[model samples]
Target: MIAGLTWLVGFQLLGELVVRVLDLPVPGPVVGMLLLFAYLRLRRYDDSGSIVIAGSGLLRHLQLFFIPAGVGVVAFASVLGRDVLPVTVAVLGSWFLGLVVVGWTAVGLERLLGRPRDDLGDPPAEAAA
Candidate 1:
């Protein structure tokens, strides 16, 4: 039990270190999750033991941890309401823009390589002899 708690704290600390040192926009736990994913991929440590079981249990209850943050949001709902329209427009536009941009980028590169799928065909070639 003590070991499991220490492991959890260690991973969380490592995650916080990466976020604080690199100044990532995302939260420490998110960064830590990415790092943990990478570590799991690299190390190939797949076992149903303390780490996985404990982490899964914590994640299963993660929603409860956010309740206080949601309460804070409720308290400040009026501030969010005042700018909802513009925020909605900006959020929707940027979300769609990112999707379009990523799709275009992928399609454009695929077309350049003559994939011929997704309507990305190559230039016409001369008839073969």
Candidate 2:
């Protein structure tokens, strides 16, 4: 358990480093989790490796991970109840708007770069042939 906690902290720091350097939009800890997940997936283990066995314990007690969050929910019940809809709307609306902006930016970028949008157009390189 102590080792796992240390590992988590180290990974989190590593994530912050990458996020800061890359200027990623997502949170650092989220990037760390993605890095850890990618590492776990890439690990080559022997057939008799115990990684699976070790992971089973964490999976079994996954609900325990949410205990602190549950406590927060209880402690803030009144505040949550009072502003739930506003909070939900703000978060959801921001996420939707972000998606829209990102989509539009991508389309604008593709057009600016002159990438062919469809098969109906001859390849730009071939047009000079």
Candidate 3:
């Protein structure tokens, strides 16, 4: 577990260094995750690997990670209240946009895969017959 944690942190630090040196617009953590993914793919690590075990352990307690975000929200409650309208609009807009995009993508994939729609179990003419 210690080794796994060390690897994770090491990759994150390496990512941070690369981002800083390259002056990247992307987040260091995101880059680190990509790097980790590539490394895992190249090495073909199995599920029983130390890193996987550590990652699973972290995921099991994922809610604990949100404590800081929750605290931040409470700390900035006044700021959030002040801009509730814009925040609400932005949140709702993004949600609706995501829904529409997901729906479209699903439909596109269904057509591409030549899958029959669940609703259309039988053709209209066949149903009438």
Tell me the alpha-carbon RMSD of every candidate.
8.2, 10.4, 5.5
Model 2 segments more than 4 A misplaced: 1-9, 46-51, 80-129
lDDT head-to-head 1 vs 2, winner: 1
lDDT tens per residue, model 1, 5-77: 5677787789999889988888887777777778778887677656677777778888999898889877887
Per-residue lDDT of 1-129 in model 3, one digit per residue for the tens?
A: 988988899999989998999999999988899999999999999999989999889889989999988998778878776789999999999999999999889998999999837786666896789
TM-score of 1: 0.57
Using TM-score, give the best candidate's number.
3
lDDT digits (tens) for residues 1-129 of candidate 2: 555556666778999999999999989888988887787678863434444454455779989998988999778778777788999999999999999999789878989999736655667886868
Candidate 1 Cα outliers beyond 4 Å, as residue runs:
23-25, 88-129
What lDDT is reached at residue 129 by model 3?
93
lDDT of each: 0.79, 0.78, 0.90
The lDDT-based order of candidates, best leading, equals: 3, 1, 2
**Clashing pairs in model 2, backbone N/Cα/C closer than 3 A:** none
Question: Number of the top candidate by lDDT?
Answer: 3
